[model samples]
Target: MTTEMGNPRSRDIVLIILSNSIQRLTFLPVYHHATVVVMCCLWLQTKQSLFPIALVTNASVHVIMYGYYLLCVMGLLPKWKRLVTDCQIVQFVISFVVSVLMLYYNFTGFGCSGILGRCFNAVFNASLLTLFVNFHSEDYAKKKQG
Candidate 1:
């Protein structure tokens, strides 16, 4: 809670980016990337097996990027947690922990690479979800309502 003096959380920056999405220019990249990926998948289905798989794999990358932004733009994720906790720091800690574990896994290769990598991405990327849950479960939201 002790926000030294002038700095803010990365979630604030992310929220700013989300807010800007209301403008037409800012919204187009998300839409364009999403649509292109989808179209690539559909096109890949025609005659090539590898193309389909590759398309799906690449498209999933965009799915998270654009989808997360879209959710932020829609006000689906709450915004108050940054007032109490440093989201950027928390996310960085989480990422660091996961990265250490992933390095261990890299040496061990103890399980499926695909699944492990995907789990890493999804877990680290749940900052917005965590923010939403924190906002809803905290007293601030209620206080603001009154």
Candidate 2:
């Protein structure tokens, strides 16, 4: 009887770990965008202005990507996963676009430079937190198995 219970408990642990992994991967895109936004904000602090063209491009891409994530969380966007879906792909796209746009905006000096510490961040935190939390615990397992 003890052996039977032990195996079952181990199975539960494995399922929980797998679920958490899925949760982390699913949110990778948002996390990547957030980190980039944080980096951009840090860069802007010393510059005090986002007028340079390169700055404009990078800032714009980040804003767009952030917007995508924000909308997705609010169910404004489609569920991220599809037949070919992987959240990391979205993240990679955001990173690449941000880099390319950074250079472009830097050249043109046209961009929305400040989106951090504003509605985006607050909504980002709230939505992502809630999104992941819902994927956790007994509720998630039930959903997963069903």
Off by over 4 Å in 2: 1-51, 78-146
Q: Model 1, 1-146: lDDT tens per residue?
A: 12312222223334556767445433323433333343333433433223334335444544454455577668887544343234433443554455455556656866324444434343533543454346445645677788
lDDT of 1 at 71: 70
lDDT of all predictions: 0.43, 0.44
Q: How many collisions per candidate?
A: 0, 13
lDDT of 2 by residue, 1-146 (tens): 13422332234334446657545433434453444455445545644233254345444545554556568658796443231122323443443455445446645876444433222333443454444444443444675699
**lDDT value, residue 78 of candidate 2:** 49
TM-scores of the candidates in the order shown? 0.25, 0.24
TM match of model 2 to true structure: 0.24
